[model samples]
Target: SSLGHHDIIEYLLNHDADPTITSIKNLTPYDLAKDKETRNVFRRYMAEHMDKWNWSNAHVPIEKSESTSSASKKNGSSISGKSLDSSSSLIGLPAEMRTRIERERRARAAEVRLNAMQNRGTPKPLTLPSIGNVICNVCEKSLVGLVPFEICELKFCSTVCVKNYRDREST
Candidate 1:
């Protein structure tokens, strides 16, 4: 007789019905699943039989897999009108604040690029009346073009001068 239902197929398989048992036409039940739906139904029946056979075994406890829990965690409990993850888990922002932050970041980047361009190459040494040679404020030595410094209303010849001048100004 042709297997018409999943329960019968599962029951027969569980009782050790030979999977190799072929019909007179030389086809097994697995071979008769010619379409996707029929194949899926047959697959489910096979799974049920496996489950029953596993249950009959003495050793295995058969713990449920965490796949269901993980799925529920991702989907959240919104469907059940309960809290899922906290609202703090989501990205929080008003449109204006987001736009302003982006704008400020762009402005800072542009300023950095401008400063880099201005600072490129060797800096020119500053000349002064007291020292015909450009002088360093900290060491009081002749400053070279290698280091540049700016003070209030005066340009200095070395980084030492710039730092010392600023330190003096702060006090």
Candidate 2:
């Protein structure tokens, strides 16, 4: 019997509260479950402790089964074939989840490879083409017009190239 305080209901159950005890509404705590989540919680708790409640068809813990032992033996043999140290990182995740993650990783790697291959051997437009043969001093490439510095009469293709050359010389 509760006013929907699920935590209090759980605490009462943990402390040996009688499940059959009814409230003024003539409803036991299990009967008073107002929502699906609460009902599911109650069902799972009852399933886990069915033996303690003297219930018929009690579920045995899965870890104590013979199938688990055989499955573990198979897993151990399979694990031995791989690098044990590398497998430790993903030990907690399920096989399907890990496979999905690996697939995504491979997809990203392939995308990057494709982008690199597409860009390979393609000439990048670093600067606009020059109209005359006035060459830049820094890159030795023809500039639209010589950008002359009075100090050394140095010419550059662009302002960006001239600034980079000046920065390097200053350092």
Candidate 3:
């Protein structure tokens, strides 16, 4: 949602939060989503429960996610943790390096999920990484709306940079 509280947002969606319900400003939940991941939550739900909600009336913008297909996990609460898309942020790294980066990413996500599961007594606010404003070390391009492609203490704009950095380190 607008607040980017993934846990609360997912809970509401799972519990039948109506994305079609618009605000006074005429913004639906998808419209108010602060980032890609938040929108993914809505996309995942609409994909799994196609008949449960009137999606066409929800005003979801087209191409917001790849979850439009029937990628339903059969009553799964979080489908994202299971796999990464082909266009993952770590695309530029070598196979071994990509594997390492993905493991790190998955570990971070798993930690967040565990925290959310444990805090079921009350809805607690969660904060995600703020790597959007940082520029890539190699290309100097802004990383906004892009993945926080990283390795060790270094962050890069792309996997190629990560590979280039590693190569530079060796030679």
Per-candidate local distance difference test: 0.47, 0.51, 0.61
lDDT per residue as tens, model 3, 1-171:
899987788899888887889874345788688988888777777777877877645644222234522353333533564433533334455887566555655655655584565356432222234542665544445666778577664467678867766776677
Sort the predicted structures by TM-score, highest score first.
3, 2, 1
Residue ranges of candidate 2 with Cα displaced over 4 Å? 24-26, 54-171
Model 3 sits at a Cα RMSD from the real structure of 17.0
Choose the strongest candidate by lDDT.
Answer: 3
User: Alpha-carbon error at 101 in model 2, in Å?
Assistant: 43
Model 2 lDDT, full chain set: 0.51
Q: Which stretches of candidate 1 lie over 4 Å from their true place?
A: 1-3, 33-38, 45-171
> Ten-residue segment with the worst summed lDDT in candidate 2?
55-64
For model 1, what is the error of residue 31's alpha carbon versus the real structure, in angstroms, after optimal superposition?
Answer: 2.0
- Scored by lDDT, model 1 comes in at 0.47
In Å, residue 47's CA in model 3 sits off its true spot by 0.6
lDDT of 1 at 35: 51
Model 1, span 27-115: residue lDDT tens: 45655544544444445544455544332121112222356445556777434422354232222657664555456445546545634
Top of the candidates by TM-score: 3
| lDDT score of residue 166 within candidate 1 | 72
